[model samples]
Target: MSDEDIAPGSDVEQEVLDDEPKSILLGIIGQLRKGGDLSRVTLPTFVLEPRSMTERITDFMSHPELINNAPLNTDPVGRFADVVAYFLSGWHIKPKGVKKPYNPVLGEFFRCRWDFEDGSTAYYVCEQVSHHPPVSVYFYANPQNDIWISGHVRPASKFLGNSAATLMRGTHHVQFKRSWPGEEYTVTLPNVYARGILFGSMYLELGDSVVLKCPKNDLVADIDFQTKGFFTGVYNGVKGRIKRESSGEVIYNIAGKWTDSIQFTKASTSEKKTVFNAATAQIHTKVPPAEDAQEEFEARKLWERVTKGITTKNLDYATKEKTAIEDNQRVILKERAAKGVTWQPRFFTGPVDDDWSFGLKE
Candidate 1:
């Protein structure tokens, strides 16, 4: 069976059919709206999903085909368009209305890999590098395709009456090994939102504009994520165009739904082709089991008990463990601060910089 066929469930998923958790979440929103920080608020463990944010970090790898053959394209401009399709593939991994994922503890990290059918492995690593601004640093590399992605996200979220909007402040660095003098493309992230939170109909929508640009190739893709409108609109709408960076002349027109497929049309011939198909796509995010993962770098190992408590509907156990973990992280931060020691990311050198060098060539 494929990895996507496996749902996020444990022996405990069956026990979490109660509706009492919604009231607790609603109360937090009222407090947060009054200038209370989301980071400082203590969320009820009953609302926790069975997975960790570190596990959700692997969602980008859900579309392996898009990234695998992108670097093989001879036309750097066309390749940039394919990369844009790839960047759009990470959304809508789960059905809407699910509870929020467990926030990663400070110093928490996750490591996993996907072995492609072509014998290439897509390796991924994510670290919760900051707590105050809630920054997550991630690295994805596929040795076979000679493609590497590195980025860090510092998300600023606000409750906009009925919906919560998160503006992602980050740039995804995509590098290829094929042609164009070893060029790199910077891919911007789309805005995230959860709609109908105030009236009880909760669904996700990715909105706003995102750009993908390759300076060396003079290629650019302008993508617009459209949200569902009040009277007449569809959910998960997306539209875009690919153009030359110098002349601003569109080479291709792109459009599709985020929950289904994306198509690109050539401006010259008006021939349209589907670039990505989500309904038929499958992804494999391989992480070691809790029993086998390394002590420090393992996501499953660190959150095993909490995961068990969540899955088994043991709220008391889950809440107790979650509190303990957060408390320990605070104590560790204090000790490190007292000694004038600063914690550094293991892979990312300058997590805050615009151009973070991988030193792959260095």
Candidate 2:
């Protein structure tokens, strides 16, 4: 199947840009230097996915079932493998092309809830804690199932000659509230590369290494997301090994294409089994409250007009609405500065030691 066949909302024309947008992009490309920071770049509305980054972060929770029962596993190795499966499941849910979500304004937030078949519910809240460097902090909780996750992401974008890369700098803290209360498993992110941005068919790829570690269990999974080379190499390939931290003994060997299936083989017995199959997995829906019911700063409510314009193929209106929101944010920041006041995030705190955290932790 094609990438569009698997991507949700693929019916929308996302991959191809109009003549006007193409010219705009070409102009921007001409001005950008190789290795230039893209944080301040104003991309056209056509390249934006109809959502804010604050809400987009919830993609990681799409396959909540993969982790709902993780705490029930008594074996630490079994639990760790489940975490790996959950982490790898999120990458396949991207849009059909090289599109980026709206850069959320400071203090903007998104909240949603997932209702599982078993009647248990998971709640998630995400906030844009910083705007300059673009740090987003989020928290997820399924108290009834004893699962909790809190993390922050600071994406740093850079322009390569023919590609663009977003260095995902962040940490995810996953914990089982009931099974192993204080035992936290830390997970790092893989950098995202948008290849062929200046020439061939533009496509997104996750590259570099992702480290998932549990110090208490002395286990670490070093997964490498391999990017396709210009003339060779397969897309979406991933390879890794789970090892004991103390002695550096390999426990399980992991290999496969993340967009298709990931399998793990036992180190000693050589027994192989499929861990995650993206094609067959069902992505659960997250239900955010109705837009009319959301607060002014909520992601969906804040970008409602812009999202509506994008979805309806009205790029000019979308650009106008998007610019209005950004201009309003500037006005708010200037007002705060004039009053000698600080703009604080409504749902998150810190960067105290370079760590932004959810403020309301239960």
Candidate 3:
């Protein structure tokens, strides 16, 4: 039977599933998990470069002159072997299917800082592919299309030699693209949200397939929809409460336990302060429980991380090393801000030429 015909509970299925305990473990433990054995979960990410067929084929032994000069007495089987050898000689070889190199990364995770919109941004690590291989696309079937403008991956230094210290990978690095759709209304994601959900202009059902192409090569990775609907980013914060609303009613809220179809009474003056008075709406946010130190700590850390990443890229630096140092410095400032420290940077412009020459006095 073909691969798809195999049933999930069958031996073949079990074998396939059991073969990659590492990926499953990585998916569960995420980035912060400690211990020496768990350290392998972090892989050095790399982009694959594209190779043309002509460049790949030029060195092969199957060139016409080499094949045609074979002995006349060569048996049919021997001659067939010769033909096979000729063709196989120069086709640039690499594993053709899933056996291709997979550099799984524990991608940098951060809280979605977009307050004006409830959205989830994901950096899916996949083989870079230029053309649409065997894959599918779905969205709200509108003429204008739901896809926003596409952007390619930037040249970022990546960790080399297995350790997380990044190295400059390549000039022709992996090619990737990112796109978002335009929606009518602005949605808000509160700082305390433990999970994030974004509604697309298009809807997709469970078991449907979509393909995400890799930027560097022509590799295409197919992802099947396990759950119907929107993409989810479960927050690492365990202390705060979270809620989701559609129209007027609360669709989801995770506190002590997960609940749906519930309404939230305002838990705080701060919570009430942010509520909207509309026809009906959904709200999710962190209302820090009084005296809950652990929850407060986690929330503050998440806030600091998001703000630092957003702020550091804009700062000027004398050199790249200076820029790196400044970025770390900004993180310290972010932590201070989260703790309500009353400190701000002293702004200054370049000094004007002194009036020491006495030209201004004259």
State which candidate has the highest lDDT.
2
C-alpha lDDT score of every prediction, in listed order: 0.73, 0.87, 0.22
Clashing pairs in 1: 12-311, 12-312
Model 3 root-mean-square deviation? 28.2
Displacement of the residue 233 alpha carbon in candidate 1, Å: 3.7
Better of 2 and 3 by lDDT: 2
TM-score of each: 0.87, 0.94, 0.15
lDDT of 2 by residue, 45-144 (tens): 9889899999988989999878889999999999999999899888888888788999999988999999999889999999988899898999999999
Model 1 alpha-carbon miss at residue 129, Å: 1.7
By TM-score, rank the candidates, best first. 2, 1, 3
List clash counts for every candidate, in order. Answer: 2, 0, 16
Clashing pairs in 2: none
- What is the per-residue lDDT of model 3 for residues 91-182, given as tens digits with 9 covering 90 to 100? 22222211111211111111111111224221111111111111111011111212111111111221221112111111111110121112
A best-first ranking of the candidates according to their lDDT comes to: 2, 1, 3
Can you write out model 1's per-residue Cα lDDT over 1-362, one digit (the tens) per residue?
12222234411111222356666678778776632345556778864667777777577778878878887788777688778888888785763353567777776777777888888888887777777877777888897788888877767767777677767787688888544446988888888776655554455678899999998889998899987565454557788899998999999998988778889999999999888777787766585545754675366777778889988889899889888888888898899999999887665566444534342222
